[model samples]
Target: MDFGQIINLSLGYIFSPVTIAYALAAVGLAVHFGYAGLLNFGMAGFMAIGAYGYAISILSFGLPWWVGILIGCVGAMIFAFILGIPTLRLRADYLAIVTIAAAEIVRLLFTTQVFDEYTNSADGLGGYHAGFRGANPFPPGTYGFGPFTYSADQLWVRVFGLVLLGIAVYLVWALMRSPWGRVLKGIREDEDAVRSLGKNIFAYKMQALMIGGVFGALGGVVFALPSAVVPAVYQTSLTFFIWTILLLGGAATVFGPVVGAVIFWVLMAFLDAFLPALAAVGVLPITSIQAATLRFILVGVALMLIVIFRPQGIFGNKRELTFVK
Candidate 1:
C-alpha cells in the first residue's frame, strides 16, 4: 500500500470544492435546527433545486451564469415558502416530515421523463459551466504542491468555493449575533415565549426556512461547479452526511461546519485508502468493492460514539443540543 498516496488523498480534502460545498450546506442546517429549531429534513431538496435550476437555466434557457444562480436562489426560496406555509405553524416534526417528502418529490420530478428535454431526466444536465470558466481570473497553468496540483480552472473553482465558504461563515456569525438571530435562537429554545412577546413566530420560522434553503441552494451550486447536476447526487444520504458534519464540528458554532467538513473528509479519505490496502494485503477478508462500502460502516460507528459521548458536538454547547422541551 502506498501510504504517501493515502496521506495525499486525505490532505487533498482540505481544499476540495465538494468539502466546501457540504460545509456551506451544513452551515444552513446549523441556522435551521441549531438556531431556529426548525426541523428541515429535506435540505437535499434545496440543493437539488439550486443545482438543477442553475443548470437548466444555463442549458435550456441560455441564461448567464450569474442569472442562473439567481434563478436557482429564487427557486429555493419559493420551495421554502411553499413548504413552510402549511407546516411551519405546526410542531417541528411536521416540518421534518413535509420537508423530507418534498425533497423526494423534487428529486423524482427531475427524474421523470416528461421534463427530460430540460432536466435530461435520470441522466441529468451538463455542459453548463462554460460561463463559469470564462469568468475565471487565473492564468492558464497548474498550481500547488505535489499530489495537490490543479489546473487553472480547477484552482479557480476551489478558490471560488473558499470565498463563498468564508462569506457564509461570516454571514452566519453576524446573523447569529444580531437581534433577529437572538429571536431565532429564542424560537429554537422556546417558541411560545417569543410568540407571547408579540413576535410573529410563524413568520420567523418562514424566514429561517428561506434563509437556510438559500444557503443549501448556494451549496448545491458550488457542489455542481465541477460536475453535472445529477439527481442521484441529492439523495437522502446527502442530507444525513451534512447532518453528520454539522454535528461533528459544532452545530451552533460559526466555524464548526468548516472544521467538521475538513475532518470528515480527511477521515473518509484515510479509511477509504487504508481499507482497500488492507484488503489487497489479505489482512481483510473483503474485496475492494466491499472495502468501499465498509468505510461508511466505520464512519457510522464513529458517529454513534460521538453522539453517545459528546452529543453537543466538538464545538457546540450543551444548551444548543437541548432542542427538545
Candidate 2:
C-alpha cells in the first residue's frame, strides 16, 4: 500500500469544494434541527433550487454572476417560505415527511422532460461556470506541493468556498449568541413555553427555516462551482449525509460542521482509497464494491455508537439536548 498516496487522498478532501459544501449544509442543518428543533428532511431541495436558480439566471437571463447568486438566495428563501408556511404549523415529523417528499418532487421536476428547454432535464447544464471563473484571481497554473495539489480553478473554488463557510460560521455564532437565538433555543425546548412568553413562534420558525435554507442553498451553489448542476446530486442521501456531518461534529456548536465536514470526508477518502486497493491486492477480504458499501456501513455504525453513548456529539453540550425529556 502506498501510504503516501493514502495521506494525500485523505488531505485532499480536507480542502475540497465538496467537503466545504457539506460543511455549509451541515451548518444549515444545525440551525434548523439543533437550535430551532425543526426537522427539515428536504435540505436537498434547497440545494437544488439554489443550484438551478443560479444556473438558470446565468444561462437564460444573461445575469451577472453576483446577480445569479442573488437570485439563488432569493429563490431558496421563497421556496422555504412556501414550503414552511403550511408545514411548519404541524409536528416536526410532519415537516420532515413533507420536506423529504418535497425534495423528491424537486428532483423529479428537474428530471422531467417538460422543462428541458431551460432545465436541460437529465443532462442538466454546464458552461455556466464561465462568469464565475472570470471572477477568479488565480493566474492560471497549478498550485500545491507534490501529489496533494490542485489546479488554479480548483484552488479558486476552495478559497471562495472557505470564505463563504467562514462567514456562515461567524453569522451563526453571532445569531445564536443574541436574544433571537435564545428564543429559538427556547422554542426548541418547549414551543408552548415560548409561545406563552409572547414571542412570534411561527414567524421565528419561518425565519429560521429561510435562513437555514439559504445556507443550504449557498452550499449548493459552491458545490456546483467545481462541477456541473446535475439533477442526480439533489437526492435524499445528500441531505442525510449533511445530517451525519452535523451529528458527528455536534449539532449545536458553531464550528462543529466545519470540523465534522473535514473529518468525515477525510475518513471517507482514506477508506475509499486504501481499503479497496488493499482488497484488490488480496491483503483484505472484501471486493471493491463491498469496500465501497462498507464505508457507508461504517458511517452508520459510527453514528449508532455515538447515539448509544454520546448522543450530544463531539462538540455538543448534553444540556442542549432535550431528548431525555
Candidate 3:
C-alpha cells in the first residue's frame, strides 16, 4: 500500500501553504462567531476580494506585490463595511443570510463577463507571481528534511505564510486581552446588557467585522501565493471548511484556529492518500474515486460528532463558548 509514501505525503501538509491559508481564514471566523457572536457566512466573499484585488492590482495596474496585498486588505474591509452597515444592527441570523447571499453575489460578479478585462471572468487570473517571487530571499536550493523539504520558492511561500499567521495570532491574542476585546466578548454574551452599559454595539460589531474580514482577505492572498486566483475556489464550501476548522479547534481561543487547521488538513491529507491506496489494494470494496469521496463523508460525520459532543471544541471553555447559545 506504500504506507511510507502515504505517511510522507500526509505529514507534508503540516507546513503547507493551503493549511496556513485555512488557518488564517479560520482565525478570522473565530473573530466573527467565536468572540463576537456574529454569524458571518460570507467569508468566501472576503477571500475572493482579497485574492482578486491582489492579482488584479498587480496584473492590470502594475502595482507592487505588497501594495497589492494592501489593496486586498482594503477591499475586504470595504466589503465588511458594506455588509455590516445595514445588517449588524439586525438579528444574527439576518447577518448570516446577508453574508451568504453577498458571497454568492461576489462570486457571480467575478464570473460575469463584464469585468473580464480585469477579473478575466470565469477563466481566473494568474502570472502575477513575478514580483512576489522576485522578493524571495531564499537562494535556488532545497531546504528542510523529510516531509518538510521544499525548494527555495516553496520554502519562501511557507515561511511568509507562517510569519503572517504568527502576526495574526499575536494580534488576536493581544486584542482579546484588552478592554476592547472584553467588550466584544460581552457583546457576544449579551448585546442588550452591553448596550445598557452605554456601549455602541453596532460600532463594535462593525469594527470586528472589518478586522476579521481583513484577516480573511489576507488568507486569500496566501491561498493565491502558490497558485492562481480562480473564482471557483471561493465557493460557499470553502467557508464551511473554515467553519469546520474553527469548530474543531476552540473557536474563541487565540490558537484554536491554527491548531484546528493543522489537524483538519493533516487528516484530510491522510485520508486522501490512504483511501485511494486502500481501494487500489482491494482493502476497500469501493473504487478509488468513491474512496476519495468517502473521506468527505467521514469529515461530515466528524463535524457532526464534534458539534454534538463537544461544541466548545478542544481549547474552548464550555462556559465561554457553545453553539447552543
Candidate 4:
C-alpha cells in the first residue's frame, strides 16, 4: 500500500502553508466561541474579505503587498463591526445564522460579474505574487530535509506564515492574560452578571468580534500566499473546518489551535494519501475517488465524537466549556 509514501505525504503537512492558515483561522474562532461565547458562523466571510481585499488592493489599486495586507485586516475589522452591531445584543444563535449567511454573501459578491475587473469574478485573482515574492530574503535555493523540503519561494511562504502564526499566538496569549481578556471570559460566562458590575458587555463582545475577525483576515492573507484567491475557497465548509480544528485542539487554550491544526491536517493528508493507495490494492470496497470522499465522512464522525465525548477538547478545561450555555 506504499505506506512510506503515505507517511511522507502526511508529514509534509506538519508545516504546510495550508496548516498555518487553518491554525490562524482556528485561533480566531477560539477567540469568538471559546473565550467570548460568540457563535460566529461567518469566519469564512472574514477570510474572504482578507484574501480579496489583499488581492484587489494590489491587482486593481496597484498597492504594495504590505499595504494590501493592511487593507485586508482593515476590511475584516469593518466586516466584524458590521456583523456585530445588530447581533451582539441578540442571542448567540442569531450571530451564527447571520455569520453563515454573511459569509455566503461575501463569497457570492466576489463571484458576481459586477466586480470582475477587481475580483476577476469566478475566475479568481492570480499573478499578484510578484510584489510579495520580491520581498523574500532567502535567495534562490532549496531548503529543509526529506518531505519537508521546499524551493526558495515555498520556503519563503512557509517562513512568513510561521512568523505570522507565532505573532498571533503571542498576541492571543498575552491578551487572554490581561484584565481585558478576563472581562471577555467573564462576558462569556455570564454577561448579565458582568453587566451588573457596570461593564459594557456589548463593547467587549464587539471588540472580541473585531479582534477575531482580524485574525481570520490574517489567516486569509496567509492562505492566499501560496495560491490564488478563489471564492470557492471561502465557502461555509471552510468555517466548519476551522471550527473542527478549534474544537479538536481545546478552544480556550492559547496553543490549542496550532496544535489542533497540525493534527487535523496531518491526519487529512495521511488519509488523502492512504485511502487512494488502499483502493488501488483492493483493500477497500470503493474506487479511489470514492475512497477520497470517505475522509470527509470520517472528519464529520470525528467532530461528532469530539462534541459528544470530549467537548472540552484536548487542551480545554471542562469548566471552560461554556458554549452549551
Candidate 5:
C-alpha cells in the first residue's frame, strides 16, 4: 500500500468539482429539511430538470449557456411551486412520498422513448459544452501537483464549481440571517406557533422549497458540466448521497454541508484506494471485488457511529438536533 498515494487521492476528492456540486445540493437540502421542516425526498428531480433543461435548451434551441442556466433555474422554481402547492399543506410524510415519486417519474420520463428526439431516451446529451468551455480562462496545460493535478478543462470546471459553491454558501448564510430566515426557523421549530402569529406557514414553506430547489438545480447543472446529463445520474441514490453529506456535516449549520461533502468524498476516495491496496497485500480477507462494496459498508458503519455518538453532527449546535426526527 502506498500511503502517499492514498493521502493524495483523498486530498484530490476533497476539492473535486463533483464534491462541490454535491455540497451545493446538500446545502439546499439543509434549507429544506434542516431549517424549514420540509421533507423533500425528490431532490433528484430538481437536479434532473436542471440538467435536462440546460442541455436541451443549448442543444435543441441553440440558446446560450447562460440563458440555458436561467431557464434551468426558472424550470426548477416552477417545479418547486408545483410540488409544494398541494403537498406543503399536508404532513411531512406526504411531501416525502410525493417528492420521491415525482423524482422517479421525471427520471422515467426522460428515459421514455417518446422523448428520444429531445432527451435521447436515456443515452443522454453531449457535445453541448463547447460554449461553456469557450469561457474558460486557463491556458491549455495541466495544473496542480501530484495526484491533485488536472488538465486545463478540468481546472476550469473546478474553479467554476468552487466559485458557484462559494456564492451558494454566501446566499444561504445571508438568507438565514434575514427576517425571512427567522420565519423559516420558527416554522421548523413549531409550525403551529408560527401560524398562531398569523404568518402564512404555507407561503413560507413554499418559498423555502423554491429557494432550495433552485440550489439543487444549479447543482445539477454543475454536476453535468464536465460531462453529459444522464438520467441515471439523477436517481434516488443521488438524493440519498446528498442526504448523507448533509447529515455528515451537521444538518443545521451553514458550512456543515460543504464540510460534509468534502469529508464524504475524501473518505470514500481514501477507502476506495486503501481497501484495494490492502486486498493486493493480502492484509484483508476480502478480494478486490468485495473490497469495492466493503468500502461502503465501512462508510455505513462510520455513519452509524456518527449518528449514535454525535447526532448533532460535527459542527451542528445541540439545539439544532431538536429539528431532526
Candidate 6:
C-alpha cells in the first residue's frame, strides 16, 4: 500500500460531508439521550423519513428544492411527535423497544412494494437533487491541501453542512442554557422532582423528542445529499454509530456529539487505512478483510472501556445522568 494513499485517504474524512451529517444527527441525539433522558433507538428512522420526504416531495410535487427540504423537516417533526407522544408515557424500555421496532417498520415501509411508485423501494430516489446541486457556487477545480480536498460540489455540500452544524450547535447551546433546558436536566435527574416543581414532565419529554428527531431527520436529508436516498441506508447500524459518537464525545455537552462524530469517523478511516498496512507487512497476522472487520471490533472495545470508566461520557456530568432502571 502506498503511504501517501493511506495518509490522503485517512485525511479525506476531515471535511467529509457524511461526517458533518452524523455530527448533526449526534447533536440531536445529545438532546434525546444526553439531556432529555429519552431513549430513542430509532433515530435512523427519523432520518429516513426526512431523506425520503424531501426527495419524494421534489420528485412528485415539482416543489422548489428548499421547499421540499422544509417539507422534509416538517414531516420529521410530525413523525417524531407521532412516535414520541403515544410512547413517552410508557416505561423506558418500552421506548427503546418501540423506537427500534418503529425504525425497522419505517425502513420496511419505504422498501415495501406497495409504495414503490412513490418511494422507489429498494432502488431509492434520485434526479431530484439536480436543483440542489444547481445551487453549488464552487468553480470546477480540486480544492484543499494534502489529504484534505474536495470537488466543487463536495466543497459546496460541506460548506452548507457546516452552516447547518453551526446553527444546530448554537441552537442547542441556547436551549441547554435556558429554563426549558434546566427542566430537561431536572427530568433527567428526577422526573418526580420536576413534576413536584409544577412542571409538565411529559410535555417537556415530548418536545425534547420532537426537537431531537427534527435534527435527526435534517441530518438524514443532509446525509443523503452527497449520496442518494437508499432505503437500506437507514438501519439500526446508523443509529448505533451515532450513539457511539455521542458517547465518545461526551454526551450532554453542547458540542460533544459533533466533536465525537468527527473523531469517530476520522479514526475509523485512519484505521481502515493503517491497520491493513500493518497486517499486510507482517506487523500483524490478520488479512485485509479481517483487518476491516477488526476495526469495528476495536472501536466497540474502546466504547466499552469509555462506558466502564465514565458512564457520563467525556463531557457529561455524572450527577446529571438519568438512571431509569
RMSD (Å) per prediction: 1.1, 1.2, 0.8, 0.8, 1.4, 1.6
- The deviation in Å at residue 69 for candidate 3 is 0.2
Over 1-325, each residue of candidate 2 has an lDDT whose tens digit, in order, gives 7888898888889888999999988898899988999988999999998889889999988999878887988988998999988999998778899999988999999899999999999999888999988999999998988645888888898999999999999999999999999999999999999999899999999999999999999998998898899999899999988888888899889998899899999998998887788888998798988887788889888888877788788899888876634
* Candidate-wise lDDT, in order: 0.89, 0.89, 0.94, 0.93, 0.89, 0.87
* Deviation (Å) of 228 in candidate 1: 0.7
For 15-75, candidate 4 gives per-residue lDDT tens digits of: 9999999999999999999999999999999999999999999999999999999999999
Tens-digit lDDT string for candidate 3 (1-325): 8899899998999999999999999999999999999998999999999999999999999999999999999999999999998899878788899999999999999999999999999999999999999999999999999999999999999999999999999999999899999999999999889999999999999999999999999999999999999999999999999999999998899999999999999999999999988999999999999999999999999999999999988998878774576
lDDT of 5 by residue, 224-291 (tens): 89999888888998998888888888888899999999999999998898898899899989898888
- Model 3 misplacement above 4 A: none
lDDT of 1 by residue, 1-325 (tens): 8999899989998888889889989999998888888878899999999999899999998999989988998999999999988988878778788888999999999999999899999999899999999999999998999767999999998998889888888999999999999999998888889989999998988898998898899999999989899999999989989888988998788888889999998899889999989999998999988998899998888888888888778998977765523
For candidate 4, which ten residues in a row score worst on lDDT? 316-325
Which clashing pairs does model 5 show?
none
| Residue-level lDDT for 81 in candidate 1 | 94
Residue 84 in model 6: shift from native, Å? 1.4
Q: List the residue pairs that clash in candidate 2.
A: none
Better of 1 and 6 by lDDT: 1
Report backbone clashes per prediction. 0, 0, 0, 0, 0, 0
Q: List, residue by residue over 62-138, the lDDT tens digit for candidate 6.
A: 88888877888888888888887789998879999999999999999999989988999899988887888888888
